[model samples]
Target: MAALITRTRARWFAVAAAAVTLPRAAALTARASALTRRSMLLGAGTGALAAATSAAPALARPAPSDGAWAKHDGAFAGVEFDGFKKTPSGLEYKVFEEGYGVKPTAGQGIKAHYAGYLLDGAKFDSSYDRRSPLGFAVGTGRVIKGWDEALLDMRVGEKRVLKIPAALAYGKRGVGPIPADSTLVFFVELVAITG
Candidate 1:
């Protein structure tokens, strides 16, 4: 499944306008940045990190071939993942649109949009409402565990439904709008990968 890249692929496609180069003098500050190498190293972080690999691994199971559903089917707020695939770390995802574009590697910057919901169908957050994608370094703990694990397997422009277990999410110490131990659901689309 391959085709020429199109501008209409995802919401709005845009890569970094310019490659950022941090001055050597900022090395120490960079080391102290939120994504420190010592803290991140990925797999060393948790079971979720075990999902990261050099190449995308085969999905344990794939969703229905039909791929005929909208993001608001309300299936995301439930625990059932009838046609989803499971990663080694317990993250469940259904890839509705395969982008066949460049897949992000560890430490690479990614731009993605997401709509987050709770198991009870309560809405929490969404990048769509913001009209801008979220940016972060994949597999570097800059985001939640499930996100870090899933993004590595996703290619730019791919859209997926993710069922994130509590362990791979905020866990017992849930953040605002999310109850403790609450599993999360998200309709995520990879917009771009840069740096």
Candidate 2:
């Protein structure tokens, strides 16, 4: 089941990097400095994932360089996934049937609140207690690739469930309470978007 869901998500990951990168070059014209830092952070995260892989022998494995099936199967690769629909902007997402909002975008700076949980349904991080929006640039690498992808096709006032595979997430050595090679789930709300 998890494998299926991960394969589903991996299918979207390829399109995600392209989708966000295309819009970013032009959009960052006015905010070059901030965008640069965000890009650095993202690069750092990617580097971290690579480094994490070498840390634990239990987590050591080659990743799929192409296709969602291969990516998920090797990394997070199996299980059927449901719930989100693909949009023209390249985001596959669903609004909570009981609530409302729009998809997110890469260039839009967002003020959001979120909670991160492991596949076993254990919560790792939450913004509710902080009573504040966690500000971040959507696709510039300020956050994990899963988040960068999930939040890119949204509009203001949107909420999303970001189902993340281990590759787009912590990869091998999971951060803090998250386990090595863990899959993550996030409930995120875009409270506001600012220039």
**Where does candidate 2 have its weakest 10-residue lDDT segment?**
64-73
State the lDDT of candidate 2 residue by residue for 105-175, as single tens digits.
Answer: 66767777776767565677877656666887788988887788766655554455566777787789768
What is the alpha-carbon lDDT of model 2 when measured against the actual structure?
0.53
List, residue by residue over 37-99, the lDDT tens digit for candidate 1. 222221133232222211122321222221122235333322345657888889988764565
Model 2 C-alpha RMSD vs. true structure (Å) is 21.5
**CA-only RMSD, every prediction:** 17.9, 21.5
Runs of candidate 2 with Cα error greater than 4 angstroms are: 1-81, 85-93, 97-107
| TM-score of candidate 2 to 2 decimals | 0.51
Runs in model 1 deviating more than 4 A are 1-80
Please give the clash total of every predicted structure, in order: 0, 17
lDDT of 1: 0.64
